[model samples]
Target chain A: MNDRTTVSPSARTTIRRLPELANHDRAMLYSIVDEAYVCHIAFAANQDTHCIPTAHWRKDDYLYIHGSNGSRLIKALSAGAQASVAVTLLDGLVLAKSAFSHSMNYRSTVVYGQFEVVQDSAEKLAALDVFMDKIAAGRNHEARPGNSKEINATSVLRISLAEAAVKVSDSLPSDKDEDLDLAVWTGILPLKTTRGMPIHAESGEHIAVPDYVKNWAD
Target chain B: MNDRTTVSPSARTTIRRLPELANHDRAMLYSIVDEAYVCHIAFAANQDTHCIPTAHWRKDDYLYIHGSNGSRLIKALSAGAQASVAVTLLDGLVLAKSAFSHSMNYRSTVVYGQFEVVQDSAEKLAALDVFMDKIAAGRNHEARPGNSKEINATSVLRISLAEAAVKVSDSLPSDKDEDLDLAVWTGILPLKTTRGMPIHAESGEHIAVPDYVKNWAD
Candidate 1:
């Protein structure tokens, strides 16, 4: 399933301007989305558009994003609006030989699709599990599951990754031959997302941080 | 000019859901934009909408984003379409007491405005400087500036931060009293963006790494 053929890009998903940087591999797109902790979802709020940053998790071909049931964007999505989701993982800073060529090395996926509100209680409950387990393995069992009351108050929208585009620039800075002779330093300063020592909450003082939290470095 | 009064949120920019976490402080918004290395910009492409991850920098009242002249999103913005720019700084993970409350600590800024294409050569050059200097101080001068040809090949869009909103969730996970007694560990796992050692490019073998690069911990 993780093949370029599975991710057939339409006119919207096609990377036309800089086609060289576009990757058609489905696995690459999945990896970028999976590794990212947040996604910026753009949905039409009346005539105007609003892009919101929210936590997201992926299950198979669908990307699940949850928010308060009262959110304007969530309401719009739940009402069946085409949403554009962008997840970008910044890998490093590319110091090019020239200022114009300077850029960032990032793996970004843009998925354009209509969101389907997961209404079934069973599916919604399972979707909540995907959120926790995706972030940290075994977190679903460790934490108390969401009760029906709490689950009903939250809204989950699922966007299929079937129509998505992945753009990545993971290489070293490419410099012009003329600029190579310049005395300026050219290279990449890799950026990494790291987890610091977990801080126990006021109510969590007695419980020990599980192995999942300790080894949770995404 | 960096006052909440300047960043007056309009109806479209207001946060109706979870309004308590919304911040109107302009400085907080500026700091979030300044600290972020990349931003996701959404623009319309005929019947389709595209959200792209691109490098962005902020000046006093304007947020500047540049892209290839041939890019569809850049062209759309230049053609006076309303652009939605979202900059998100993920700070940590909030492991709530229950799955329903699982959230992320992030400072996100969403700006809604019609981008004005920067036409002046002098202003475009200065904007490029802001891109590098904002990310790494003093590196703009060290590298060669964009020549007229390069400048002409790039399309720069400036969006005012006037109609903008900043949403932040920085608090620890809040769980219900009933769930607190569960054996699960609940707390915050802080996420930090750190820079690793600078890697020299093929042409930068002999040049000493500059102080600006060494001290460049964003």
Candidate 2:
């Protein structure tokens, strides 16, 4: 973890709507990015704006994503196109007495910057290992490591997390004073992403379940 | 539901990477949009691209979103700016014997279009009702409806779902023949968004829990 405690929002990263929900603490940004399995990235290509979802991982103060060398997203970002990435985790639904006051509880972060291509082979391999570790701890060492040919076919890119904005809404329902006395049911309906029992592949059923898989649902 | 069976993919909506994983079925597109609580919208404004997450809902052939009239997203899209919207649902992590073969099972859809503002007051109100129903079936009737002033402050915009692409990845792990004998525990680790117990607001604890809240987790 870095010693930085806060992020300096860029012109585009500043939150204008409901600024009270904006958070600047660097740890909050890291946690939001770390907990999410995928992030939606927006970039312009061929004079068109595109939003695409892909797996993401964090290493130090940078967010990393990998894709085939010929992919449109990789080609566009590697060319130094300005991009915005968003990761949102819906925590719950806040039902207020007033329809206009209804809201959602969520933790979301948006990062703005140009992606830099990871050109060094060693750095690229280490980054991929970090991504694999994110998927399943200790499995990276056990799985067949990527061969030169496989690694060569992929392109890894990283963007700094300095210019980012975090917004978290975890409060209970807040209705207008006049609507508070209404007889409608007001509450929070919590939502969480949970893991289910692991299913072993047909060829690997004889292998023992790893600690990561065993503790996944817990 | 409309009788439309498929979406005609435009040049921008065509899935070039992993084309076989793409589905043109209109029902698949609707199901993906209907099941998602939020979508990431990508649009270019002020010479920079932005990807932001916002609550969304579908009614008939259009996906709708509402925001404060002054919000950046609402303003940018209402100006006829081209946009791309993506909704992604991650189902599981696919672990394979080889690190390079690791994949994710997901249902994702991307729509490319320009959002048009809902000008009619009655139409906007009815669209918001559909959104409320998605949050809770009968809560719209019980909650204090939005007054004229509140309704006027909100901007509702809808984008046609005709130019959309659906991609569903539900296959098992597939590793190379040479790596099949590897001893790694390969399988699927499922992930699902689940509802937790309802939490009543302090002022409304006396009210009975609605059936939607009661059956949320089930």
Clashing pairs in 2: none
Writing each residue's lDDT as its tens digit, candidate 2 over B33-89 gives 999999999999898899999999999999999999999999999999999999999
User: What would the per-residue lDDT of candidate 1 be over residues B1-218, giving only the tens digit for each residue?
Assistant: 23544466787777776789889888888898898888888777687766778888899888998988988878888898878899999889888877777778888889988999999988888888888887678888788888889888998889999888889899889888878777778778889998887777854356768896777665
Which parts of model 2 have CA positions greater than 4 angstroms off? A1-3, A203-205, B1-3, B203-206
Q: Per-prediction DockQ, in order?
A: 0.71, 0.85
- For candidate 1, list the clashing residue pairs, or say none: none
TM-score of each: 0.94, 0.97
DockQ score for model 1: 0.71
Best-fitting candidate, scored by lDDT? 2
* CA lDDT scores, all candidates in order: 0.83, 0.92
CAPRI accuracy category, model 1 = medium
